[model samples]
Target chain A: MAKKVNSLKYEFIKGLWVENPVLISLLGLCPTLAVTVSAVNGLAMGLATTFVLTSSSIIISLIRKFIPHQVRIASYIVIIATFVTVADRFLAAWFPPISKELGPYIPLIVVNCLILGRQEAFSSKNNSGRAILDALGMGSGFILVLVALGGVREILGSGAFFGFTILGDWFNPWMVMILPPGAFLTLGFFVAGVNWLNERRAAQ
Target chain B: MKLILLFISAAIVNNFVLSYFLGICPFVGVSKKVSSAVSMGMAVTFVMVIAAAVTWLIYHLILVPFGVEILEYVSFILVIASLVQLVEMFIRKVSKPLYDTLGIFLPLITTNCAIMGLALFSVLREYNFIESIFFGIGAGAGFTLALVLMAGIREELELADVPKHFQGAAITMIVAGSLALAFMGFAGLISI
Candidate 1:
């Protein structure tokens, strides 16, 4: 029992960093860069994604035995898309402002390679419990990165974090940090940070 | 004139890759080589054009009329997946050389958010049929332009001695960040 728990714990923990979907695997980047202009938006997108990722992963894991190899990809997409639709509508209904800000991105989540990749890789091969753990790990990792990236961009661009003022009148907010370039630049450095950490860990 | 402005806007001012951040997988993954980037661009543009037309019809004529508009996400994705599959098969049958060039990319295009984003954007913006097509072409052109530019720079970057940490995708991303900065200059150049 202890051994089983340990392995499962590793499955979940790996996605938090070592096999991070965003930083390490670099999947589902379009949404990462698009909606992460602000920390709030990043957190919203991350939670929405986590909901879909966890839900779909559990479903796929449950049905893994029944899915044939040839049609598995298609089956996975439909399953994934269904959950995305739910998330999209849920956001639109409950959070009108976030829904509008996120715009087509909610629907775009249907195509997010991160969700689909997890289905193909983790869920399809593992049990529902492991799939759930994996989904949460990856989801948290994704959320962590988004919130950090968004926090950095927001603080620099608007002199605020999560809509609260951080920098004073003396500091000039860099408009470029909130624009498209900032997304890439911030994410680039974040990627570097992850790489550096991994290298340090490896060397030791 | 409106169509032309839309095209230019989509292609330059509001580039899909730079502004909207769509189809980034191919932008980063396949952009290492100029040759492969061009090929991927062509494949994506071809699908985008067709997807624009077909999705417009589906959203307006089919979904709207049937009152099943909530099916938009599921339907659009299904259409794109099958469309790519069908296009791949048709290309393989119709022209060997063309298929040889684009075959590998067709499979990858299914998950490319840009194509789906284009469809959703047109629907959200309430663009008419012709405008949607122009937008598709423009987005594709913009994607191709970004990919080609990134590829060219990366080819050159192959020689530059880079730091140990910020290499590979990390460096590519920073370079893209610079390109995006340049593209931002075109922000108010035109508005349509």
Candidate 2:
């Protein structure tokens, strides 16, 4: 509470890596781990989340005053669900393959704590400008982590990066990387790695 | 036979927490004590079963017949949110002890994602009413299994010398990764 948070810059920069929704804050982990099997899927999911998140933030911010406090969460859920439907339908129509690959996870985004969390924490309290910026920053952070995770998984599982063969012919792909464990293992290590990085940065 | 297979598939083979990553939040968040975990699991199970049956009815009876499937996400979420509220009030009125145990977790269940995922999955699988109920039970059971297992291990982990950086969420995830590997053995155990 002590740090100056009034500037718009604070809201935007916080989500990129400082307080990353996935790696740091640990708000939205379901979709983060589920669809990160490939970089493409991760990017699509991230973008879709970004759209829903930003749209809901704008609407929630505008109607923040009108929503009764007792039923505010319900209202937020409805607002979020509306945008999620829009994103889900848009994805299905424009990109069928990725949509199929992501499957229920897209609609599952409505319940993603990251989006709802931002609305409750920042959007409901802040103005629309800050809400949009917060959404963009957090969404970018989520996108970055997903792409990194998916890229790593894809490379290890298939000896390829984004569908291109990266490892040599002699490389023995860890087929387990394609399975569910790969996601948990990769994320586990990534979180530990991020912690170590922060520790070292602080030691300096 | 199909119902049995579906039940086993969702429970063990395709665990909601391990394979599908549906409810990782509670899997990692509330899985600190065996007792609380058990309570959360029961609450989630109750909601999952009911949510499955109700959402199935809503989707098939109302959304599909009226060609308003577009409202699927909105309506399903609304149903789940309100359902949790109703279930919470009912429990508080019926049993004091049970309500106290599941007090905090009930509201949180609105955002659990597992229930949402279960509803979405039943729709995707196109299970009939009975089968959907079975699937709900299986998913809830599987979720409980994962949460309780994590809780038990974490209770023991309280004494272990976890690494400095991997102490909190990191270690839990690694443990979960191992559990997932163990659970993966169930994969293809029954090809049905």
Candidate 3:
């Protein structure tokens, strides 16, 4: 029915904001907080994650029916790990600087619960097409958050966006924005801000 | 003496959880109780040491020799996953009580970024076999220290009336930020 199609659309759309992986689910906080010291790092990490996520979702969807229920989690992880390997190797060989900047995080993507959580929750149950769409939506949402975090940190920390200076001589960088503590503090406030916005919206 | 300093620096001066921000998931999730946190920490330490040893051999002996160092991420992840499963089964068969305590945490360890991060860092730093093992133990101990301290704070925090928006994860993060700042004092202790 038309209603079914509409609901499928809703499922894909919701991941963008309503249930954003970073803000709402709080999944994959490791990379989100770690690699966002620069906008370029965030973009690279986000795109790499998207590649793994989209590819794994498609593959999982194609074989969802054949995978045994108990072993599904293991299967999804293996698939994800394989794709991550490819991404990591590609980055190291082609983009060594970004790879080094990201450090071990590129490999850490394998265990990112966001990808596995999606496979278990949505991809396993849904058809291949819907799963791909949902994966894309969620991946895009994650990328947006990474870019925003990276932009804020990069601009404030070094007066740059993606290695290009956005702030002029008048601006003095907040040195903490590039440090480990800044990651926690910034994300903490960002999450609280998201919650506050939700509350106001609901009240309205 | 140098090795001991490496261990101490990694474990305390540059803690994986508090300073480096690796493995925040379990740092927050499993740190609700002191006992559970201790168990999780020990389990992580055990796997990390083994993983460090195994991955070092794989990287230096196998991957590098084959000129396929590019496969490091893939192989490391797969190795960690299988290692977790192997350790879980071995523990269950050998020690029931220890298995019971570490039962749920074993599977969770597979996803703990600290394990994978330790492996990658070991290779990146080109640490030798013994150094890698020490790094693993140090990172594990660091993770445990952070988790237990956070749990202790949370226990006391249960009494405090946190602001509405800062409750739960938000407040936990802010507290962790302060802890990270405190840990920063140790940074100057070791030049490495």
Candidate 4:
């Protein structure tokens, strides 16, 4: 029982830092880069993804035994698409503004490699509780990177935070930071920064 | 004129990769070599064209007729997955040379959001069948153009003195960002 608890803890924690789905694993880049134009958008996208990831992880874990080996990939995709549709509709109904902002990306989540990767790699092999924990960890990690990226871009690009002005008047916003190029540049530097920290920690 | 604008717009102004951020996995994963990049682009183009055609029919003929639009996502994805499988087998049987060229990238197209995004975007825009086909071609062309450009830059980037941490995917992204910025110049070309 103790060993099982420790393993679950490891599985959960790994996604936070050691195996961050975005900064480290690089599993889901499209949504991570595209929808992160603002802090709020990033937060919404992350939460929606977390909801989908966690829910699908639980369901997939529960059905692991019944899924045939040959058609597992197809089954997983259909399952994921169903959950994504639910998330998409929920967003559109409850948060029309955010749903409009995210646009097709909400549906694009159905193809997010991160969710499918977790389903295939973890949920397919693990028990329900452990799989959900793994999903939570990964989803949290994804949210962390996205929010961080969005915050940085938002603050630098427009001197705003969740639509509130954070940077002082003296600071001129880098207009490029808010553009498509900015997404790539900010993520590039941020990824390099993460790598540098990981390497330094390992060396020490 | 409108069709031409749509084709050019999808291919350049609103590139699927730079602007829409679709197919980013293959953009980063298979962009190491120019030869492979071209091959991947062609395979994706082939699949995208077929997917666009098929999904339109599925949406218009069956889903819309039956009033089951809610199943669009699930059905579209399943169709794409199975279509890719069929394309793979068809390619292997009909033309071994083409199959050899495309190799594994064909199978990888199943999960590529660019194809699905193409279907979704065309549907979202309410594009007619002809426009959807042109949109697919244009998007595929744009994806190819970006991938090849990145691949060429990466070949030269191999020798450039990139910082240690920003060596692989990081640099690739930064380069893509610049390419995206360059591609942004075309936004003023057509205002559709």
- Deviating ranges (above 4 Å) for candidate 3: A1-6
What is candidate 3's lDDT per residue for A113-149, written digit by digit as tens? 8999999988898888889889988998899889988
For this target, which candidate reaches the highest DockQ against the unseen true structure?
Answer: 2
Q: Ten consecutive residues with minimal summed lDDT in candidate 3 chain A? A: A1-10
Q: Chain A TM-score per candidate?
A: 0.95, 0.96, 0.94, 0.96
lDDT string, candidate 2, B1-192, tens digits: 989998899899999999999999989999999999999999999999999999999999999999999999999999999999999999999999999999999998999999999999889878899999999999999999999999999999999999999999999999999999999888888774
lDDT per residue as tens, model 4, A1-204? 453544778888899999999988888899999999899999999999999999999999999999999999999998899999999999999999999999999999999999999999889988999999999999999999999999999999999999999889999999888888899989889888998999999999
Show the colliding residue pairs in model 3: none
Per-residue lDDT value at B22 in model 4: 95
CAPRI classification of candidate 4: high
What tens-digit string does per-residue lDDT give for candidate 4 at B49-75?
999999999999999999999999999
> For candidate 4, what is the lDDT?
0.93
Model 3 agreement with the true structure over B1-192: per-residue lDDT tens digits: 778888999899989987667899998798788899999999999999999999999999999989988677778888898999999999999999999999999999988989989998998898999999988988889899999999898889999999998888888888888888888888889867
lDDT of 4 at B93: 99
lDDT string, candidate 1, A83-196, tens digits: 888998899899999999998888888899999999988799889998999999999999998999999999999999999997999999999999999999999998998889
TM-score of each: 0.97, 0.98, 0.94, 0.98
